[model samples]
Target: MTRQVRRLAERTPPQRERYADLLRAVAITAVVIGHWLAIYVTRDGRGFQGGSILQVASWTRPLTWLFQVMPLFFLVGGFANAASLTSHLRRGGNAMGWVLGRTARLLRPTTMLLGGLAAAALTARGLGAEPALIGVAVWLASIPLWFLVAYVAVMVLTPPMYALHRRAGLAVPIILTVLVGGGDLARLVLNVPYAGQANFLLAWLAVHQLGFAWQDGRLPSRRSVALPMAAAGFAALVLLTVVGPYPVSMVGFGGERVRNTSPPTLALLALAVTQTGIALWMRGPGNRWLRRLGPWTVVVAINSMIMTLFLWHMTAVVIGVMLLYGTAVMPDAMPGSALWLLLRVPWLACLALVLALLVTLFGGFERRAGRWAASVGTVKGVWPTALTIAGVGAVLAGLLALALAGPGHHGPTGLPVRVLVAYFGGVAALGFVRRRYSRPARIAGR
Candidate 1:
C-alpha cells in the first residue's frame, strides 16, 4: 500500500470504512442515470407513460436492484453515525449535539433550495403562467427534496437505534424479516395503504438498523459479506415479483399501481444488504485506487459537494430540455420507440453537460458554514443547537408557508403534502430528541 492508503487504513473508523464513500459516489451516479432514463426514456411530450419503457426494457423491473441504491446511502449514514457517536461518547462530547450539528449542516442547504424554488415558482406565477404548468413544475422540482427529509430522520434516530443494535443482537434482523413478510401480507389482505406510507418507520428504519450492525461489528466478517448479501438480494427480488404487490421500478412512473419506493418494500432492504456486501468486498481494491488517485484530494473534493450534486442534477436536465426546445435538434415529441431511445443518447449527453455547468456555478450549497458565517460546526456544543433550531425553523416556515399560501402555492408543501410533512416533521423530531439526550455527555469532562 502507498503512504496515503496506509494512512487511510490506519485512520479508518471501525464503523465507517473508506469504501463506503466509494459506494456513495457510485450509488448517487446510478440514481442520476436511473432518474434520467425513467424520465427522458418514456415521455410523451407531457409526462411519463408506464407501458412504453417497461415493454422496451422488461429488464427495467430489475433495475430496481441497481436503482434502489438509496438505502445504501442510509446504510453508510448509520455507519458514520455509529462511529461519530462512539467518538463523541469517548471524548465526553454531546452525542446529541454532534448529530444535530451534522444534521444541520445537511439540512441548511436543502431549506435554502426549497425557499429559492418557492420564490422562482412565485415569480413565474407573477408573470402570468398557467396554473397547471406552474403546479407541475413545482411538484417536479420538489422531488429531490425527499432525500433531505429521509436523511434527517435517519440521523436523528440513529443514536438510540444504535443502542438497540447492541441490545437486540441478531434478533434485530429477525424482527425486520417478520415485518417484511407481515407487511406484504397486510397489504394484500387489507388492500390499503398500510404498507405504503405506514411502513416509513418500519421498512426504511429496518435498513438503517442494518447500518448499526455494521457499526457494532456484528455484521458478517468483511471477507464473507458478499455471498449472503447476493443471496438475500436475489431471494427478495424473487419474492417481490412472485408474491408482493409492489412494482419493481425504483423510480416512480405515472401509472404503476404499486411503487417499490413509496414505502420501500422487503425487496429494497434485501437489495441494500446485497449492495452493502458488494461494497464491502470491493473496499480493499477501492481504497488502493482511491489512494493512488493522490492525496485523497479528488474524493474529498467530491464528498464536499455531494449534496449540491444530488440536489441539482435534475435541474441540469430541466435546463437542457428547455434550451433544446424550439429547435430542429430538439425532438418534436418525447421518445417512446426503440429508435427514439437510441436518438436520446445525444440528448442525455447534453443533459449531463448542462448539469455539470450548473453544478460548477452553483454548488456552494455543500460548503460548511464558517464559525463567523452561521456558527454551524461541531465545536462548543453550540453548532448542533443552532442546527436543530434552524432545521425546526425551516420545517415550521415551510409548514406555515404551505398553510398560508395553500397547497397550490410555492414552497415545500407544493409536493405531496403528506410526504413533505412527514419527512420534515420526522427530521425535526429526531434532531430534537437526539439533542435532548446528548446534553449530559457534553457536561462531563473529556
Candidate 2:
C-alpha cells in the first residue's frame, strides 16, 4: 500500500488541482461516515429493522446541515468534468466517447454492487430468510445508487451544459437558481403537483454550473466573492427555512411535509451556494496544504477507489448488523439512549473494519474497469453520440427504478427482472457501442 501510494504521488502531474481530489475524497468520506452514524438498527423478537437516528432525535436534523456534503460532489464534478470534457474536445474527441469515458468508472463498480446484492438476496431467500427482512436490507444497501442516478444524469448533460457555460458564464447558474426558486414556489405555494421534481435536476445543475465557473477562473478564491456569496446564501437559508416554509434539515427526514433535499428547494440551493463559497474560500489554503506529499498521498489513496468505498459502505453496515445484531452478538438499546450513544463507538469500529475489507475486495474493479474503458478508442459520428446518450439514459432510469423498487421489492431475487433488464440492456448497449464503433490500431508489423 505504501509503495502504491508513493508511485501514485510520483506520477501525479504538478498542474493537476489537488484540491478538487481532496474535496472529492472528503465529500465521499463524510457521506460514508455520516451514513454509518445516522443508521439506527434494532432487533426485536420478530426480526431486525433499520432506521435513521434523525427519526428519533430532532436535534440531529440540524446536524445534517454539516453532513450534507453531496453538493460538494456536484460542485467538484462540474469542475472536473469541465476540465475533462474540454481536454477531450481539444484532442478532437467526440461527445459520445467523452460521455462513455466519464460513465465507465461509475457503471463498472455499480454492476458489481447490483450483482452482489442480487446474489445475496437470492441466497438469503433460499435459506428461508423473510422477504421483509430482505427488502429492508436491499433498500438500505442500495442507498448510494440514488445519488448515482442524479449524478449520471448531470454528467450526460455536461457536453451541452459546458457549451452553454462557455457562452453564458455566471448567468447560467443564476438562471438555474431562479428556476429552482420558482419550482419551490409552485410546489409549496401553488401546491402544484410535480413542480418541485424539476429542481432535482435544476438545483444540482445550479451547483454544478458553479463548478464550471470555478474551473474557468470566473469564480475566484477571493474573499470578495466568497464572503458575500456565503453571507447571502446563509441569509437565504435562514429566511427560507425559518422565515419561510422550507424544512431546516438539508436531508430528507421521515414524515416531513416538505424536505429541503428530496425534490430540493431553495433552502437546499442556498446550502449549495454557501458550501460553494466555503469551498472557494478554502481552495487557496487547501491547495497549498495538499502540496505536501503526505496529505496528497492520502487524498490520492482515498480517491483511487472512492466510488467503491461509497457504494459498498452501507453493505458493510448490513453485514455488521447481521453478524453482531442478528445473532445478538451486540446488544441493542433505545434509539437515543445514553447506552446507544456510547455503543456507537464500537459499532463504527466494526463497520469500518468490514468496509475496509469490502473495499479491498472490490476497489480493484474500479481501477481495472477504468483502464479498460480508457483503452477503448473514442467513437465519432452523430449516431454514436446519440446512442451513447440513450445508453446512459437507460442506465440511469434502470438504476432509479431498482433503487425505488428496493433490492428485494420483487421478492427473493433482490432484483426486479424488468429493471435488471433495463440496467443490463444499457450496459450491453454501451458494450455494443464500444465494440461497434471503437477501432483499435493494428500492432506494428502485424
Candidate 3:
C-alpha cells in the first residue's frame, strides 16, 4: 500500500455525518432542476419551457426558491473542506499537497467535459453549420464552467483563507458584513465592473470559511443553529427587497432588473449565513436519519461523482429538450393558463427519466481510478501552493472572459463558443499533466 493510504488506515476514523451526504444529494438534485429550468425555454420562445414533454411544467419556478441553494452548496463545500483538511492535519498529511490533490480531482472531470464539448463544436462547425448556431451551442454548453472557475479560486486560496479563519475568529463575519454592506452601497452609487462576479471568490469563500468553523466546532450547538439561520435568511430577504438593489432570484435570467449574482451582493452573503445556520440546525436530526439510512455507501459512492453530475446535468437537460423538439406530442408553446400548468406533471416526470438515464451513462467520471491512488506527493509551502492555484485560475478566467463577452450576449449568436472551446482544451491539458505527474503514494493518500 502507498504510504499515504497506510497513514490514512492507521488514523482513527473521523466523525462521519450521513446528513451531509444527504444534504449534498439534495443540493445536486436541486441544481439539476435549476439548470434544467433555467434553460427551459418556452415554445413562443418568450419564457422558459422545453420544446418537449416537459413543456407543460412551469410550476417548477416556485421550487427555485426552495432549491436554489447555491450558497448551501458552498456551505457544504466549506464543511467538507474543513472536515477533510482537519482529518489530513490529524493524520500528519501534507496540507498543501492534500489541497492540490483534491482540487486536481475536482478539475479533471470538468476538463474532460470541456474537451468533449469542444470536439463536438468543432465537428459541427466543420460541417458548415451557421456560426451563430455554433456560437449559441458552445455558449450554452459552457454555462456550468463558471462553477469550476469559482471553485478553483476558493481551493487555491485555501492556505491564506485558513490562516484568516484562524486569526479573524468572529471578526470574519464582521468583515463579511462590511464587505456585503459596502457592495450594496456600491451598487447604489458606482456601477462596478463585474462587481458581482468578483464576489464569486470572496462571498462564497466566507461561507466556506463557516464550514471550517463547523469543523472546529466553533459554531453554535444544533439546538440554536436553525432559528438564527432562518432569521438571517428572513433579514436578507427583507434587505434584498427593500434596501438592496439585488434581485430575488438566485439564478440569473435575462430580464431581471438587477442580478443577485455577478459580484455577489449583500443579499447573497445573507443567504449564505442563513443557509449555514439551517444546515447546522438540522445536523442533529439529519444525522440520525442519515445514519438509519444504512451505510450510505450509495450516497458516499455518489460523492465521487458530484462534480460530474454538476457538470453534466445541464447537458442532459439540453439533450432531452433537443430530443423532444419538433414533435406534435410536445407543445411548441409552453402552457399559459393554469390548466396547462396542471397538465405538465407528466412532462416533468418524463424529463426526470431522461435525466436519470444520462446520469447513469456518463456518471462514471466521478469514480476515482486505481491509478489515482498511486499518485501522492508531499505537501509544499502554502504560498507556493496558493500561487499555483491562483495562477491557473487566473489564466482560465481571463480566457473565459475574452470568449464569453460580447454585444447582444442575450441573442443566440452571441453565446461564447471559442472561449468554451479554449476552456475544455485547457481542462484536457491539465488532466494530461495530472496523469503524467500523478504518484502512487499521493493517489493512495487521496
* Model 3, C-alpha of 287: deviation from truth (Å): 0.7
Best by lDDT: 2
Q: 244-272 in candidate 3: lDDT tens per residue?
A: 66665655555555656666767767777
TM-score of candidate 3 relative to the true fold: 0.80
- For every model shown, what is its TM-score relative to the native structure? 0.78, 0.95, 0.80
Residue 176 shift from truth in candidate 2, angstroms: 0.8
Candidate 1 segments exceeding 4 Å error? 1-16, 41-59, 192-196, 242-246, 294-296, 333-336, 369-446
Ranking by TM-score: 2, 3, 1
The TM-score of predicted model 2 comes to 0.95
How much is 42 displaced in model 2, in angstroms?
1.3
Off by over 4 Å in 2: 326-329, 406-408, 439-446
lDDT per residue (tens digit) for residues 280-321 in model 1: 666678867765445354455555567777877766655565
Error of 1 at 82 (Å): 1.3
Backbone clash total for model 1 is 0
lDDT of 2 by residue, 133-174 (tens): 787788788889889888998998998999999999999999
The lDDT of each candidate is 0.61, 0.85, 0.60
lDDT score of model 1? 0.61
